[model samples]
Target: MISHHLLLCATPAKALCCPDPAAGQASWDSLKRLVREWGLEDPARPEGIVLRTKADCLRICAEGPVLLIWPEGIVYGGVSAERVERILREHVIGGTPIDAWIVKRLPFRPAAA
Candidate 1:
């Protein structure tokens, strides 16, 4: 049996914030295709890919639709349908997190609103 190895971050709140869920779905759909094409889901492999969409607050509301890669602890923000394909194909499959879209951790402060 192969162990799962991939996580997708998607919260309902975050998804609601997206300009279009269709776009988000499209993005996720493409990544799924790549995972199959890359042989990340082979049952005979020692490890396999897993995509998870979580429903917790990442605390980056300004940057909705965030994705976090576990073990490596990398977080990406402001992701769209178009960019997700490249991220999965080049970064996730390639064993490198996409830094260009990373969401840097920062001190949290309550909004004045």
Candidate 2:
């Protein structure tokens, strides 16, 4: 089962979100490496696997390279390659969100299935 979906707005269609696209790509690479290295994709683990997506734009224009953690709906801004490790370890695994980096929160509200 999938535990969480990490949506990274790394490459926006327009340059409004991130002025430098390379920086965003770097962050995206970091996210992929950590996710795979940490064994988050292992189905044998009990906590479920974490899935990541490289989104062109999340529609939040100011926070270039923003990371949105779904279900809990934590939106983190200014997510550089360096910050990706901390987020995965602290927020994703430890179950505690870093308040300082958080820019917004939009908890998921699923409609009746």
Candidate 3:
């Protein structure tokens, strides 16, 4: 089963996404490519699979291409295709969060008992 989830914005509201809409699309494509390249999306992959999803809008679209790493709720902005690999390598696989590119963040909240 998949343990990690990344939701990237696919749509923009009021042209809020940084630079242009293509940036978000680029992130979506780069994210998928990197995940596949790292074997995170393979069906036969080991435990802790990461699933990448595309969303219409994140509302925090001004500084975006926003990417939300779920369960941990790490939100990153300005995630262009150029930054995907570093984000994946440093943050996703290495268990370290990248602070410089972050737009906003929330502590990973667990389900209530």
Candidate 4:
């Protein structure tokens, strides 16, 4: 079972979000590496595996290198390589979100079937 989905806007086609595309790429790389290293992809885990996607643009263009965590719908801004670990350890693994870095939160609202 997949517990969470992390969507990171790293390389936007227009470069409107991040002035430097390299920084965005770095954040994406960090996210990819950490997710694998932390074993968040293990389907057998109790919390379930975490899936990650590199989004070209998340539509919140002001905050470059933004990250969006699904289900919870927590959008974190200014996501750099240095911040990836804490976000994973505190929010992804520990089940607690870091409010400080959170830019916006749009809770999941699935339509009735």
After superposition, which runs of candidate 4 have C-alpha atoms over 4 Å from their true positions? 110-113
TM-score of each: 0.63, 0.93, 0.85, 0.93
Residue 10 CA displacement from its true place in model 4, Å = 0.3
Candidate 1, run of 10 with poorest lDDT: 2-11
Model 2: per-residue lDDT, tens digit, 71-100? 799889999999999999998999998999
Model 1, range 3-82, lDDT digits (tens) per residue? 33344444344454344565556656665776677676766545554544543455545465666665456667777667
Cα error, residue 22 of model 1, in Å, equals 2.1
Compute the lDDT of residue 110 as modeled in candidate 4. 79
Worst 10 residues of 2 by lDDT: 56-65
Q: Model 3, residue 37: displacement in angstroms? A: 1.7
CA displacement after TM-score superposition, residue 90 of candidate 4 (Å): 0.2
Between prediction 1 and prediction 2, the one with superior TM-score is: 2
How far residue 107's Cα lies from its native spot in candidate 3, in Å, is 3.2
Candidate 3 per-residue lDDT, tens place, 33-91, comes to 89998888777876678988887677776678788887688889888888888988988
Report model 3's TM-score to 2 decimal places.
0.85
> Candidate 1: misplaced stretches above 4 Å?
1-17, 54-59, 105-113
Model 4 C-alpha lDDT versus the unseen true structure: 0.90
Model 2 misplacement above 4 A: 110-113
lDDT by residue for model 4 (1-113), tens: 88889999898898887888999999999999999888889777889999999988888887878999988999999889989889999998888999999999897677899
